[model samples]
Target: MSAIVNRLAPANAVVPEQQPSAVAGLRLETRIVDGAEWDRTIAGFDEVCQEQLHVFATARWPSVKQEPMLFLADGQVVGGSLMMVQPLPLRIGHIAVSKWGPMLKDSSAPHAAALRDAMVEALIADYAERRGLMLSVLPRAALETDNSAYERLLARGFKRGSELGFPSRYIVRLGLSDAEQRKSLQQKWRYHLNKSEKAGLSFEHAGPERMGEFDRLYAAMSERKQFPDHSAYDTVPLLMALDIETLRPELFFVRHAGEVVAGALIFKAGDRAVYLYGATNDTALPLRAGYFMHWQIIRWLRDNTRAGWYDLGGTDGFHGLHQFKKGMVGEAGVITPVPPVANYAARPWAYLLGNGAFWARDAAYHIRRVVTGALRPKARPDQAPVVVEAGQP
Candidate 1:
C-alpha cells in the first residue's frame, strides 16, 4: 500500500498511444493495481460509482477486501475495475465481486467489444493467477434491459444470470424539470410527494461527520423494519476513507418541527449518483419523508454533484420498499440487474469447483428466465427472442 505508483496521462487526454500486440491486432495489458495506481486507473476511466472506487473496495471492515485492477492498451490506462473479495465458507479461496465496472476510458471505440474481450480475458487470467478460483461479477450494467456485456461474458465462456439473487433495480436520469419528473411517477407516488412537500418537512445534507446520526437511525429503522441482519459491512466507513471531496456523499435528512425524522445517503463516482442507503421512522412514514428525501436528493445531484444518473439502488421482493423507490422515479429511467459472470481460476481445486457450480448456477437461472419469458407478454409487436440491447458497455 505504501508503494509509489506510475501516473497515467492527464484528465483531458482521451487517446492512448497504441502499438502492435503479440496476438496480431489485439493489443492490451491487464495488471493488478495498488493504492495510488488504482486512483490513477479510475481517474482515467470515463464512468464509475463510489462502490467501484479503490477506497470503497479496500475498506477496513470485517470479511471484506479489495483487489483493484486496470487494463492498458499501448501503455495508457484504458480500463479499470474493483473486485470485492470475501472468503467463501468451506472453500480455501476468496470469492471476488466486481460491481458496476471494468469501466473503460472510452467504451465507444470502433473496436470496443474486441478490446473489451481481450482486456477482460487478461483480467480473468490475472484473477485466477493472483486471487481465487471463482470470480462473481455483475458488470455495472442494467440487468434484463441491456445485455451487451452479458453476451460478451458468454463469448468468454463465463456462466451468467441469477435467480432469487441480485435485487431488482431502479434509476433516475437527471436534468428533467420538477413537473416533468413528477408526471412520470405512479399516481399515488406523485400525490405522496406533493403532500410531503406541504407537510412542513425541511432538508439537511452532510458527509462523514453525520455518519453516527445515520448509524443510529439506521439501527432503529432496521429494528422497526426487521430486515435480515445486514450480511454486509456498513458502506459509510468505506466512503469515509476516500478522498471524495469532488464525489462527496450527500446525506439528506428530513426535519419537521426541527427534529430529524428520516434520512437518505447518496454516493457518487465519476458522473453517477447512487442512493446508497436510507431509513424512515414511523413518525416520518405518514409525513412521507422518504418521498421528500428522494426529491431533494435528485435536485442536489442535478445541481451540486454534476452527475447524470441517480441509482435508487435495489429493491426487495417485498412491495413496501419497491413502491417507495418507484415513487421516486417521477419520469426517471430504471435499470434492472445485469447478469453475473463467473470465471474460474485454472488451479485444480478452482477449476473443479468453478466448472461444476458455476455452470449449474447459470443453467438454473437461464431455465427460469426462459419459462418466465414464455409466460409474459411481449413489449413490442415483432419481439421474439431474449435479445440484448446492442452497444452498451
Candidate 2:
C-alpha cells in the first residue's frame, strides 16, 4: 500500500465545495513549459524581479520535473503558474502541485481575475489529463489587505495550509538628497555614521576580483557565530558564476590602512536595490565599519541609481532584527505564502502530522537553547574589513 494510503484516504473521499466556473469576470490562458525552455523562461522572469519563488524554481526546476505556464489576457501577460510532479518513495502515482506564485502583474483588475481563473482551469485540466495529480498547492503574495485570491482558492476546494515564513523586507526611500538622507536617519544612526567617519574609516566599491577577500571575511564571521551557512558564501563558484550574469553587485568596502575592514553587498534589480550580504573583520571594530558601509550604500543608491528603495531583507519576526529594519525609512511589508502539497491520499494525515511535528520541533529547539544558554550569546562588536573585487563588467 502507498504511504499516502497509510496516511490519509484519497481527497475524493471528502466532498469539496463547488466553485463557479468563472471568477472576477475574466478569462486566463495557461500553457506548459518543459525541457530546457523552463530555465530560459525562469531566467527571463528573474530579470524583472528576483523573488524567492523564481529563484527556487530556477535552482530546482531541473530536478523537480515541473512544467511552467504563462497566463495571458487581452494579449498581455498577467500571471503564471508552476506545476511540479512529485513521486513519493512509496506512492504509486505522482502528486501534482500548482503554485499561484510570482504573479507577473497586478491581480486586482477585473481582467486579471478572468485571466487567473482561466489559468487555474487550464492547470487543473492539464493535471487531470496528465494522469491526474493527487492534489495541488497554490500560494499567492499577500500584496494587499484584500484576500480575494484566498477566498477564490477556498471556493475552488483548496484548504488553508501552513503559514510560510517570509522576510519582512525593509525599504528605504532613495529620492532624498544627501543632506535630506542624512537628516532622515534616526538620530543615533546618523550619529554613528558621522562618528565612524570621524574615526578615520573610508569606503570603496568592490568587484568580482575581490570576492576572495569577501569570502574570507564572511567565513571568519560565520566561524565565530551560530548562523545558518549562507549558500552564496559556501559556494564561491556559484557567486562567481553570478558575476557573469546581469546582477549588479554594488559592494561597498570600508577600509583602514589601505586594507578592507568591512563590506556590504547590494544587489540591484530594476528601481530597487537589496542588501544581500555583509561581513566585517573583528579588528576593525573601533571604526564602526558596518554602519559606514550601510550609510555608503544608501548614499550611493540615492545619488547614482535613482532607485526608489533599498531593501534590508529578512528579520526574525518582530524581534530586534525587525526593530532595526523598522528604524529605517520605509514601513514593513509582508510577502505572501508559498503553498505546499502532498498526495491526496496523504493530505489529511500530512496536515495533522506536519503541524504537530513543526510545533514539537520548535519546542525542543527552544528548550535545548535555553538549557545550553545558546540563545544568549554576547553580541560581538563588528571588526573585520571585507575585500571587494568583481569580474569584468
Top candidate, metric TM-score = 1
Q: What is the TM-score of each candidate against the true structure?
A: 0.76, 0.65
Stretches of model 2 off by over 4 angstroms after superposition: 1-25, 34-63, 74-76, 81-100, 105-158, 164-167, 230-236, 243-245, 248-250, 270-272, 302-307, 317-320, 330-393
Query: Model 2: per-residue lDDT, tens digit, 1-393?
Result: 111111111223111224343444344444454523433444333223433233444464444565555555555555555666665434544556655442444533554444444555555445543354555554433334444555565666555544434323456767777787776676666676788888777888777788778878877887776454424443333434452243435667888878788877776644556677788887666776767777788877777764566767655333555545545542222322223322222345543443444355557755654554454453321223211111100
Q: CA lDDT of each candidate?
A: 0.63, 0.52
The number of the candidate with the highest lDDT is 1
lDDT (Cα, tens digit) per residue for candidate 1, span 202-236: 98887678878878888898777554443333657
Candidate 2: C-alpha RMSD to true structure equals 9.7
> What count of clashes does model 2 give?
24
Scanning candidate 1 in windows of ten residues, the lowest lDDT window is 379-388
lDDT of 1 at 47: 69
